[model samples]
Target: MNPLEAQLDYAFADTLPDIGHTLDVAPGVRWLRMGLPFALNHINLWLLKDSIDTPDGVQKGWTIIDCGIANEATRSAWENIFATQLEGLPVLRVLVTHCHPDHIGSADWICQRWQAPLWMSTGEYFSARMMSAGLPGADGSAMLPHFEMHGMRDPEIIAKVSQRKSYYPDMVPAVPHAYHRLADGQRLRIGTHEWRVITGFGHAPEHVALYCADLEVLIAGDMVLPRISTNVSVFAIEPESNPVQQYLDSLEKYRNLPINTLVLPSHGKPFRGLHTRIEQLNTHHQDRLAEVVTACATPRSASDIVPIMFPRALDAHQMTFALGEALAHLHKLWFDGVLTRRLDADKIYRFQTHSAY
Candidate 1:
């Protein structure tokens, strides 16, 4: 664990659920891990023991939270989970936290397999559909142009990114044609407890985190992670967005949660330092923003800021997010009047300190 991670208390410090299995993390909640074919190798999913009233009588089952990507390995893992782990109860509902491929990729498949309804925030649901369909602005095609405008001019990198046009669609081939919407502050009864929806922004469109006061547990989704800082990027669809500001503002929403809330994040171990982790995240961003401001003392493009923020070799996939995140910080500084942006002679956007400009 890193120094910041050591500050929080991990609920299961010595335990991890195997790929197709689960470990009970809270009352009626089981933790499951799935493999991702990226540098970030795993995504945590949850299974909630649940029941609901139906036309005939009370139906007993489970509710799945966050599906793995749609790939043969992931699908095979789900099949193993279904055969051995579910205890023969049906999956009554599929709830996704956001539109990200790892969270919603296999949603349609799971919902279809069990004939369960899909649930998500309106913003996430529609965004998933648009991206899955490879629509104009949401598809990978727009990434190259957007990054180029922010000054990503590497021919080799651009060539690699251009071939990823079907990246999102390939992982998330479809979304359920319909969905049940989850809204901020809405209460949902899953099993023996009620969870209140806490919508967060800047990570993804309307990401929903759930808090169950009764259980004193918060399903933090990507809002408050224990280990790595959540990626808060300015994607192509929202070019001028100041996601860094929006993400910082959204952290305030969790301040009122109990200090010892057991946070079940979408990544990392289950932890018990809600406020501490939030503080760490805030300080992390503040420090990053300070670095960005210092670097902008001279003119800098998003590409120029990428190495300063992420000082390592990046594959094409990581480069896309790196450039987007670099732009996000610049946009935040520009919005706060800490820097000024101008189009240079090369038609690339650059940011500089106001005095320098």
Candidate 2:
């Protein structure tokens, strides 16, 4: 077994809820898994049992957290779940931890179905709305130049990128015109448990995680994970951002929390060992930073150093993320004075080790 993985202990690691089915993970809280077509095949959604007041009596309903992507198949799966799992009750509200397409894809569809208001962080809510509305910053063309500037010179890849439309609208068909904004340190009552919003950055602009101190359980959006590393990249939209550092800072904030807390991540199974996982992630990034510094011995563009950082076959879709990540690592080393970036005669920017000076 890998030494890094040994630090974490999982609950129901060998089991997953069947499609359109739900698994109980806590009191009044259930786990629902949804299918996705990407390499990460599934995303976990939470169902919180709550009730509403009516003229006659109390009405029982569920508050759904994180709707799956907006697609025919996903839509069908959700419909099936509602048909079988609801037990005659309707959806009360839709709470989103973030505005990633997979998290907020069916926001409009689900909200309209139950006449529920969408809840999410202001940044995530507005960003999703703007992207869905065909804003200027929400297109492949907008990102193509940034990718190219960071060493993505492959014509075929650039052509594919240029023609590709924003995947957000396709996955996230629409956003609710209005939303209930959640902020860091806000308390929300779902069912009988009070879940506090713990906002973090680097994965998304304003990713929110819900923590129930009494339950000792945390719905860690993408802020922390048990297995795969979270994507912390520099996008064209934020050319000068240092997300790598911001991500680490967010992880540190969780270290002082109870190490025995049950962590329900968006990707992997629920696990224990928050402190161990945070240290593992910190070391992983440090190792990657050292590798980037060594790779900078020769002037190289982000694209040119992609192989050094990630030794894998990347399709056109994966290439986009790889370029962004490579640029992020380069930017980190440059930002830390480990490397210096300069444009060569060909107008291509490359990074070299500070020792080269």
Candidate 3:
């Protein structure tokens, strides 16, 4: 077999987990994978069998994480599976890694059902509510001026900027009025096992990575993954943010985690060798940054540089996301002093070297 195929086989053999066909991980955790009407296809929900001692024969259940998009099918799956598979175990708590819909969609439903507390980083909790509430301050609306200023003139693109704002509602079964905020260094107990929360920035507001030192297992959420690179797009709320820089800073926090920890990711199969995958992700971005630098020699608009970086092309809907990703990298370079941006006569923004600065 080719080298890439061989490496994948090894990663899966040594690191990939076989949760189930519908579920992407393993069976011990009582995982349930649910479909979402998005390009990414699915999101996973994990139910850790709570081994906590109880007097009433009440089995305790705690969710390892949340699935993003919520719908009748997803909710139905939870009802059918939780009742049968869990044997009526009470959902003790819901732990969310971040504010993304696929990860936090069913949070309110589960929390409300069992009257359990929802736990997430303070930043993500607030952000999730904003997106879930269908408010004007949501990320897409916050991004309008940034795109308008950058020359995204297609009327459909503008309309989609509005439509994309509410994409999370499908997954947001309901919004939680309050949540128990998580922070770095906090310990989360699931029955007898405890997972330490690790915080990171850039990908989302205060993304959490739960690490169980005893079990050598980690619920990585979307902070780190085996296959596709996590989306680190710059949003309208922070128009000039150096998202790439923030994402790189977050990577340093994961480097010291035990390399052999079994990683339970949000999108891909669970695996070990967390550190090796971390290094690969880091290298991939560094290479991309280098390419962006090379492309900026003659000063180009963010839209122009997008095709050069992401040449495969995408659907109209996907293009909006792609443009945002491309802009994020340029913003990072601009803030890092490697590139400088200025508005032209038509208010179109362009970036080039900032040697004078």
Candidate 4:
């Protein structure tokens, strides 16, 4: 654990659920880990013991929180989970937190396999469908031009990024044609407890985090992570979006939760420090924004700011997010009037301190 992580209480510090298995984290909630093909090598999924009234009477089963990417390895892992872990009860419902591939990639498959209904926020559901279908603005094709406009001009890097047109579709080949919508503040009864939906923005369209007061546990999807700060990016579809501001504002929604709530995040170990983690996240962004403002004393493009923010060698996949995050900070500063933006002679956007010129 790093210095920052030492400040929080990790409920499961000495144990981790192996792939295809689960460990109980809270009352009626179990934790599962899935592998991802990225620097962030894993995503945490949850299984909630649940039952619902049906025509046959009370149907008992489990509700799935997020699905791993649609790949053979992930599918095989799910197969193992189904055979051994589910205790013979079928999955009751599939609820995705957002449209991200790791969260919803295998949603259709899982739903189809168990004949369960898919549940997600309207924005996330539609965004998943659009991106899965490789629609104009949401597809990987738009990323190159968007990054280029923000001044990503490296030919080798550009070549790698241009080849990612099939990125989303490759992982998430399809989405369920229908879904049950999740909304902010809506109460959902999964098993013995009721969880309130807490929608957050900037990370994804409408990310839903679940809070169960009875259990004193918060399923903080990607809203408040323990290890790394959640990625708040200005993607191609929302060019002028100030997601940094949106994300910071969204953090305020969690202040009402109890301080010692056990937070089961989508990444990192389960920890008890809701307010502490939120403060860490806020301070993380504030520090990043300060660095950006300092760097913008001279004109800088999103690409120019990427190195200052990331300060490491980036692969093609990481570069996309890095550039987007750089632009997100710039857009936030621009929106706050701390910086000014202009299109340079090369048709690339650049930002500088408002008082620079």
Clashes of 4: 0
What digit string (tens of lDDT, one per residue) describes model 1 on residues 1-357? 679989999988969999999999988999999999999899999999999999999999999999989999999999999998999999999999999999999999999999999999999999999999999998998888889989988999999999988999999999999999999999999999999999999999999999999999999999998989999999888889999988999999999999889999998889998898889999999998899999988899999999999999999899998998999999999998889999988989999988844
Q: What is the lDDT of candidate 4?
A: 0.94
lDDT (tens digit, per residue) of candidate 2 on 1-357: 477777789877778899899989888888989999898899999898887778988878999989989988888889988999878788999999887888899879999988998999998898788777757766556788777777788889988898766766778778998999999999998877899888898878899998888888899988888998888888877887888888888887687678689888899888898888998999988988888887888888989878977899988878887788788888888888888889878777899999744
Alpha-carbon runs more than 4 Å astray in model 3: 1-28, 51-59
Instruction: Assess the local accuracy of residue 221 in candidate 1 as a C-alpha lDDT between 0 and 100.
Output: 92
Candidate 3 lDDT, 1-357, residue by residue in tens: 433223442334534322222333433464456776768876656777554446877555656477545667767767776666665567777788888878888778778887877888899998888777767757455566677777677787788776666566656747688888899999877767787989988889899988877777777788877677888887777677777778889888877877677777777666676677777778878888788888888877777877877899576567667777788888888887899888899888999877763
Q: Each candidate: what lDDT?
A: 0.93, 0.85, 0.73, 0.94
Backbone collisions counted per model: 0, 0, 12, 0
Q: List the residue pairs that clash in candidate 4.
A: none
Model 2 lDDT, full chain set: 0.85
Which has the better lDDT: candidate 3, or candidate 4? 4
Measured over all alpha carbons after superposition, the RMSD of each candidate to the real structure, in angstroms, is 1.1, 1.7, 3.1, 1.0
